[model samples]
Target: MRRAWWKEAAVYQIYPRSFCDSNGDGIGDLNGILQKLDYLQELGADVLWLNPVYDSPNVDNGYDIRNYRAILSEFGTMEDFDRLLSEVHRRGMRLVMDLVVNHTSDQHPWFISSRSGRNSPYRDYYIWKDPSPGGGPPNNWGGCFGGPAWSYDAGSGQYYLHLFTPEQPDLNWENPAVREEVYDMMDFWFQKGIDGFRMDVISMISKGGYADGPLRPDGLYGDYTGQCANGPRVHEFLKEMNRRVLSRYDCMTVGENSAVTPELACRYAGFDEGELNMVFHFELVDVDGGETRRWEREHSWKLTDIKRVLTRWQTILDGRAWNTLFWGNHDQPRPVSRFGDDSTEENRVRSAKMLALCLYLMQGTPYIYQGEELGMTNTRFTGIAEINDVQTRNAYWERTERLGVSHEDMMRVVNYISREHARTPMQWTDGANAGFTVGKPWIALNPNYPKINAQRQLGDPDSVYHFYRKLLSVRKKSDTLLYGHYQLLLPDSEEVYTYTRTLGGEQILVVCNFTGKEAAYSLPGGWAGAELLLSNYGNPCSGTALRPFEAFALRHSG
Candidate 1:
């Protein structure tokens, strides 16, 4: 297999807004991240994938880009960003910024000009259409947050498409001018010595003729993913982007493609494909919510279902294209709570390590969200008012007000699936506000911070933080872990997940118990008495009986 810096590196995703507060001003800033660089280095992170810090109105927590070149005042100044980049590079860690060109804030200068008149110079910068005969939206598509995807512009007498919120208008990538602007903005960052980009909602850049998608049972709005994701010219535009700007720098690029399949991923990030280095497909994350609606009632996901999804991606993309391994991110619920047992302290630690061993040992670049190292679980939100996420707030209102669902029931779903769970302030210490800030936090911290804070974990050798450090250290030293061929073992097992990675004469075996109860599994042939590289449980016996949430990696060489 071909080797690259990105292929062997593990990325640490930092949601700056909730990471740490530097000025005691509630919000996390670039200086906050600058302060945490040593913490990340201690955890063995090679790359840092920062969430959007661009100038914005905070409608979608900085996803709505007001100015691609300017840094948000709340985040820090341009000089602060430059210092952060310099410090990151000085520490031998690369930094990747979030690229949110799929949409721009309605207040953006381009959008402001586009909405001024029908024949404005920037009119083609955004997707605008006349009302569909009856004086409503241009299409039946629904915004990702809620309501119609098309928001009316009284000045232009046309409705513009926004897949997310009315404040976030979709960009017209079909225009060569828009594409050039985006590429030039990218070059601006590359010229600043920043390492790479994490493209947000990259698959939705192309639209499929603005056709009406299939309506849901409620008949409010049509499916946006069906009409927009992986559109006709996506690959062509990506190739153009690669040719124009990305090829000039030795950079790492990972696209946030929520609607991609393994085949589509191959085209986007295949070995010979010049588009991106890797892609974040939502198949594993979407298991509980499915493709259409994620805010509804929780869907029961089984171990076999997870196995099927992970095995497919691991095997299919083994030699075709690279994969990105992550359990949770800024937009998803916590991993220990969603995929593992987080009901108890012991369970949280064990399962967090188990999940780490299960996913990180697979063939891919691993991404660790900020608080995930401390085994942060989902937040227990009691009321809608406490939630800070726009999507969660919209879903709560839609379900309780219009759909006639009970408040208690909808809040239950919010507790289970809300993105707010991951957006809670990072738990640095057991002090007030979890050491995230001294002043009021923009959002509430996860209440379990007293027990699960990073300060507490960093001091303990058996903590989840140390486990992750060891796991990454192990990965850094093993060529087999980076480029080995993956094979699923015990594919049908419901309680235990096992896999092996082999490169030439070197082999690494990973075993994980996904449940709270002890599971039984026999070692495969020629695997007895293998050298134990790492294990969550202390000095666990190499016996058939696996403890609850036990995970370990064994090495074999012949």
Candidate 2:
């Protein structure tokens, strides 16, 4: 495999609004992030991926961009951004901003001009279609958050496409002018010493236009995945984007690709294709999903299922393309709560470490979400009033009102899997508001902050925080963990997840007990004298009994 800085880097993702609050205006700002540079550097982070802090109306929590070049006032000024960028480089770390070019805020100047009238030159910058013959939406597709995908404009007497909320209108990538404008905005950032970009929903850009989808049982609107995601011209557009701007700079790019197959991923992320460095595929997270989507209340996921999907991606994309390793992000529930044992304090810490070892030891660049290193679990929200994510709130109302799902049932699902669960203020200290903000936080802090806060973990050498540092330190020193060939061990094991990484003559075996039961594991004969590199249990293994949530990485000597 070709070597790159990003390939050896351990990235930490910060959801700025929830990371910290500097001025105490009940919101996190750029200065708050600036103050935490040492905290990230201490945690062994090489790249920091900050979620969108661009100027926006906050309709979708900064995903709807009003100005690509301006920083959000709530996040601080443009000058603050420059200082923050400089500080990150000073610490020998890099910064990657979230690129949300799939859509623009309706209030953006370009969108405003495009929606003015049919004769406007910018009208083609956005997708607009006349009303259907029945005088409703242009198509039967539904917005991802809820409601019709097409919103009617009274002044223009036409409908504009929005895959998300109506306030976020889809940009017309078919328009050469729009593409040029996007490339120019990217150039503005690249010229400023930014490291790279995490392109949001980038695969949805080059659409062949809209079409009616299959009607669901609710009979309201149809699913848009088949018609909208991974559009026909996605690769073509990405290649053009690469040639125009990305190739000029030594930067890393990863695309958020939904509904993408292994073969399709190779086409979009193959190094020779000049598209992107890697793509974040949703298959592993969606393994527990129901017939409609992942938020369904009735769902069950097997450990084997997780292994199958992840192993397929690892094997298929080994040399053809790259892979991205992640469990939690701004848009998903906390990993420990979703995939590990977060029901009790003891189980939470052990299982958190186990999950970390399972993913970090794999062959990919690991992306750690804020508070993840401290084993922060999910929120204990009881009602919709505490929720901030537009998608979660929309799902609650749709499930309870339209589908006749009981309020209790919906709340149960929301508590377990809502995106808001991941958006709660970071647990920085044990003080009020988890020391995230002196004032009332924009979102309520997670109740378990007293035990899971970073201050407490930082002082304990055996804490998950220290374990994460050790993981990064070990990964940095070992080329096998970074660029070795991966092979799944005990591929069909019911309760244990085991894998091996080998490069040159050295090899490392990672064994993870995914359940709470006492399982038996006999090490391979060849690994008889291997040294213990790291373990969550804080002790060397002496028996065949693999205790609940036990995980360790073993390295073989020459």
Candidate 3:
């Protein structure tokens, strides 16, 4: 496999709204991030992936862009952004901005012009179609959040497609002018010394036909994934993007490709495909999701299923394309609570370290979400009103009001799968607002922050934060961990997950006990005497039985 700087780097994702606050404004801004650079540097982060900070109406948490070149007033001015970028480079860390060009805010100038009239010059800038025969939406496509995907404009007498909420309209990738506009916007950032972009819902930019998707089993509108994700022309557009904008700069790109499979992933981020450097796939994260929607109840996932999904991605994308290893992101629940044990403080720390060892040891670039290193677990909201995520709110109302489900039952699901779990303020200290702000916080802090704050972990040598630092340090020094071939061992074992990476004469084996019970796992042949490089527990292995949530890496040399 070819070598690149991005392949050897660890990306730290910062949700700017919750990272830190400056000026006691109850909101996190660029200056807030500027204050936290030393903290990220201490965590051994090579790249910082900031979530959207562009001017927006906050309809979808800044994903809806009103001005491509301007910074949000709440996030400080463009000068604040420039100084942040300069400081980041001075510290030898790269900064990548969130590029959300798949759609624009309804208040954006382009969308405002497009909605003026059917004959408007900017009408073709967005996807607009006449209503169907009965004067309904252009088709029965459902919005990703909920409701109809098409929103009608009273004055224009046409429906505009918005795969998300109506406040955000999908851009017309079929129009060359629209594509050029997006590329030009990207160039503006690159010229400002920004490293790269984390493309949002990039696969949905190209659509198949306007035909109605298959009717959902339990909803009024049709499914959108069938006709939207990884559409026919997505590659053509990405390739064009690479040829025109990306190839000209020394930058990195990682696309959030929804509904993507290993087969299609090779085309989007193949080593020689000249598209993106890597892509984030949702297969591993969706393991516990329901058949249709992730919010549905009674969906339980097994450890064996998790192993299968991850091993497939590791083996399939070994040399053809790169992989992005992550347990959760801003849109998903916390990793330790979802995949590991978080019921007790001891189990939380051990399992958090185990998850880090399991993922970062594999052949991929590891992405650490904010507060993940401190073993931040999910937050439980008492009522639906406590939730701030639009998607979760829509799901709660749809289930209770439309589907006749009880509020208590829906809140149970909300506690398990709500995106609000990850949006809680970062626990910097045990003080007011978890030290995220001095003023009233826009959202509530996790009550457990008093025990799991970063101030406590930074002082503890055995804390999850230090374990992650050690893991990254180990990964950075070993070529076997970065460019080695991956192979799964004991794939059918439910209690244990084991894998090995080999390059030339060196090999490293990773063992992770997934459950909270003692698991009997004998080391593979010729590996019993291998040197233990790292372990979550302080003691060396003296028996064949593994402790609860125990994880360790062993290195063998011929």
Candidate 4:
């Protein structure tokens, strides 16, 4: 492996809106994040990726940023950002701010100027296409959030593009002027003594000039790939951005390229020539979504299936671009509830440990979301009125009364798909708003907070938090865990997932029971002499009883 700093690091992602609410504002703020830095260092995270904290209208929460240069007053001031940078560095950690340049809030100064009139010089900063001969949008491209992607303005008599909500107007990366402006913003942040970036919706930067997508079987063509993602000029623009802002700094750059495949993974993170340090894939996260375009369908994700897809990515990208391994993020439901049993305590902890073993031992950087260390589960919202995400509300109305589907039928789907499942405030301790705030939170905390907060888990030796800390320590100290060759063991095991990793003649075997049933498994012939390294499951021998959800990691003599 190359000597890149990112290849050997573990990252933690913080969704600031839910992290902690300082000043009792019910919304997490800069000071709240500052208070958690020590815990982050202790958890063995070297990189911290803070999602958008920029001044925003909050139409889409922090993702729809209105200002690139200023931190939202609600979060904190520029001074707090400076303090955050200093605190991260003081702990020997690197901080990576999210770069959401794919689009800007309609309230942005550039957009305000662009939307002022047809003759405005800033009109070119955004994509504006003339009305069709019939005096309507050029094509039938749909917004990623829903409905048509283009929204017209009476003031300008021209249509602006938005792949998501109308408030978020897509920037015309096709224009050199727009690209330069974005590059300047990158320089400004880097100049602020920040480390690097985690680019949001990165693959969507390039567009196909307002073209339509191919028709689908459902009579609605919802495909957004070739029409927007990885467009023809995207890489050229990134390469130029690198030449101007990124190349000048020895900082890391990761991309939130959800639909990214192995073929293009390396191109985004391939050495000095590539555009990013790594790219995130939602392949694992979407496993339970099944064939539903959204997560409204009942689905069962198999252990074999999950292993198959992830292992293939590891094999394909072994020496290519580094893969980003994550089981949960701000957008997805908590992994323990979604992947393991939420009804029992033993099942949850064991599953969390098993999942940590699987991901941290993989071939790329591991990203642990907030509350993941303590094995937090999902939030239960019984009504649409209780939901916070706009997408959820839109989908509920569209799928229920508008489509005449039963409320019960759709709620089943909402139970699985709503982003609110992950948006609830973090459980810090046993108190009001789960110790996240002294007042009401901007969003509700998962009510299971009393049992899952950090204070309770951090001190317990058998807690999932401790297992993850040990996992991080092992990955840090053992070359095998860091850069070892990986081999799948017991590929055909009905109830267990087992694998081995070896580097510099030090070999470690990892095994786990994937279900709530006790599974019996064995090491290959002549492999019994290995010593136990770090383990949670009670035994290591063949036909050994693996209590439901328990996992094992053993170091064997070569």
Candidate 5:
């Protein structure tokens, strides 16, 4: 086994708009990020993965990039970005900017120029196709945000392909010129001394199906499965980019690959010659939701299913390649709301600890979304109109019209599951806008911030902040947590999820009561009473009962 730089590192994701507001412009800026450098170090993070801040029309927040060369005026000037970068490295931390090259904002100069006319020099930069002879789109390939993926452009008298919202046009990776342009952007960032990038939707770059997926019902096309994902030449482009730019510095490149398998995942981040350091998989995060095609609905989740998914990933990629482990991100609902009890404050922290234990203990790098340290739960909006995310709003309307799902049921599925979940203002203190901004925030602040802000958690030793600090410290300094092998202790237990991590001569056993009731069952495999290393509920006492939601990791006596 070889050591990787990210093995024991903790990553903090910053949704710039919601992190902190320094200019009093009702939005967060680069200076705001600079102000929080010390805070990130305090939270025990080594990497600050800032979401896209490039110029855009706020169509999908900042994911759409109008110009990769210029910082959005709303985020401040390039000097401010330089200052923020300086401040970040000054604190002994690295910065990973979000690389959203898969698609560019329609307002981008290249797209605008390309769409000007068929003979525009930049026209080859994007995908444009003719409609079928009879009429309608060439095929039924649906946009990720609803409607046909192909939108007809009367100016060119052809349909322009967009995998997502109409406002974002997909780059034609099949074109070498487009690939060169993407590489140039990577070089620009690396030259600026930025550490690396968290590439947005990289796998989808190699989409298999085009125009339309083999015909399906509802007057639509096919599902997202390989339809437009993991195209044949994606790795060729990635490898080229890696050689030219990414592989140069000790750069960190993590991709947001939605449905990548273990083998390909390892190939993407494998030890010998991988394209990225790690890639995020949606398996654990979507545990509650059934694994099926986009149009199908399988709502129930099983605990055994949870164990299987986590363990399988561990089993396959243990030492082969690195993995990016996470419970929540800017795109998913809060973990506490998704996996834990969202109704009560006590349960929020309790469940958060357990969820953390599960991911941080695994064989991958842990990514902690902002506000997760405060055990932040979900916020429920009454109507779809209140939601600001384009995907959520579009899905809400489309699902209701197509599936006939009741409002309550529709809300139930997406209540807190959209990117809007982690995009809300970060709760800093119990003040207006949760101390994020002195003025009205660009987005709504989570309501529980009054008690759950970072200010309040920083002082308490038993707070989630401290637990995270302690967890990171242990992972960094302790042998077992860092280089240990994992063993599932009780695979059949219905009420508890337990496992042991061992390295060299040291071993630690972790057990958690996944439900809300006290459980007292014999140690199934006879690995009994060890010193309690850490617990969310109480200390390790073999004879004593396990309280509901009680969690503990105990070390074996030498």
Candidate 6:
């Protein structure tokens, strides 16, 4: 109903650790991101959402914040971060920092004081409870990174709650002091001129009092997602956050909401709610995974299923709420690997372009992860030793040892769904380490970099990188693509995903062939003479059948 700057802007998410290395430290830093500002501007991104670069033990790769006001020593000094912010603004781009407030690193000073004794003032800064009568965790809740959610602290003789790894202790959001501190920390950044935050696991900040949950079939611990995710006080806390700090600033806020539905999403991101500008819901990405158990097994998701998931969000949130459009991120496998065919070079480039045309043309703010525009494919990790993500390691142990699954089978699943797949160093050049770093990479680089690096694609007009640039340019100029109404076409077609966007007197028809073979696609009756605005294959189609992975956007020139 109303227009917002964020709604019209495109966001590019940078996993800083893998973006580039400036000091040859084998890790990406603020200076490295500063060096890439021109590259981002050339790509037509108006917003840059960088992953966490705060002081951390890196137990969960910067999600565990040891200090709210400090930058990681490895990532450079605060002055470097200041210069980064300055340069981003100078180039007419906004910077959105990754805000991790649901938990603090166990090594944080507050956690250190809280674990000192039972009566310490900071003790309530975290959730601490006496162990169950049987001398185990306070409840049967399982940590997302594996094992019990409560870790025993021998000194205090109490257990602390951690929804993720034990190194990341859940913060007590119910405590007024804690909430005040969080808001204060947020203000500290807003004062520093950050455009906004991509709040990590923001929905899990509030918990409905600790309790045992339904046990998994393995009988080790219970799934606490229901009890913890989008907990009772989540909205209350978010609303208070807005009233205190966010509303005062003219900025954007997106929450990492895991277990949210469209109805609930409306409340969190509704324009009038003053909670969040948008929220990243995983329904579209989690299409293959089971409802509660993700990455435990592999699944074959159909094109119709993906269409259903996306169309629902588009139609419902069109005017009521907002959505964040993304296919890959630091926590997801590459889109070409997960949703497209990456078996061959041609297919990789074609499908990558197809997927981009499908999502970028939708009605929402689109986020492009680093290297995604280069048509990067998943890494071929040989063994468990090659992975670095804590979640992936935990899942390996759970599926193989705890669930009695075979090692080969578990590795197969990891190969397909591991977050490590997305953490590979950015492939800049087809040189050593994909030109990401002169020293050893902090993580492995996808071997396909030689064939899919940016150096090879930047000059090629038909490359995925250029295609994405064209898409962003088109979106910038076309009101219909940015704010138009979305209507699903051929909703039940398994081979073709089609949609139309209309605004005022303009209408654009989009058709995507979602398969490895040529798909029989026909114009939607009266749209036969529509003017072709975009396409993956060279020029407009000569016939109705689209080539393998072919995609097109047609504007009805009526």
lDDT of 4 by residue, 92-175 (tens): 999999999989999999999999997888898898877777787766677666667779998878888888889999998878
Q: What local distance difference test score does each model get?
A: 0.90, 0.89, 0.90, 0.81, 0.80, 0.89
Indicate the worst ten consecutive residues by lDDT in candidate 5: 290-299
Model 3, 61-180: lDDT tens per residue?
Answer: 998899989999999999999999999999999999999988999999999999988888999999988888887876778888888888889998888999999999999999999999
Kindly report which residue stretches of model 4 are placed more than 4 angstroms away from their true locations once superposed. 212-221, 290-292, 538-542
Per-residue lDDT, model 6, residue 464, is 91
Clashing pairs in 4: 20-28, 26-442, 296-413, 530-556
The digit string of per-residue lDDT tens for model 6 on 453-487 reads: 88888878889999999999998888899889999
Provide backbone clash counts, one per model.
Answer: 0, 0, 0, 4, 3, 0
Q: Global CA lDDT of candidate 1, please?
A: 0.90
Residue 108 displacement (Å), model 3 = 0.3
RMSD of each: 1.4, 1.5, 1.3, 1.9, 2.2, 1.5
lDDT of 1 by residue, 383-404 (tens): 9889888988988898788889
Which 10 consecutive residues of model 6 have the lowest summed lDDT? Answer: 213-222
lDDT of 5 by residue, 1-558 (tens): 777676767899988988899988889888998888888898789999999999889899988889898999999999999989988888899999999988999999999999999999999899888887766677777777778888899998898878888889989888889888899988898999998899999988876657543455544333554566777777887888888777778888898886788878888887766488888887876666623323233355667777887887877887887777788888788888877776777877878887787678766788999888888878877788779888778878877887787777778767646667777888889988898999888878778889898888888888888888877776777668777888886687767788877888888777777777777755544457566667775565465457767777777745
Model 4 clashing-pair count: 4
User: So what's the TM-score on candidate 6?
Assistant: 0.97
Ten residues in sequence with the least summed lDDT for candidate 1? 211-220
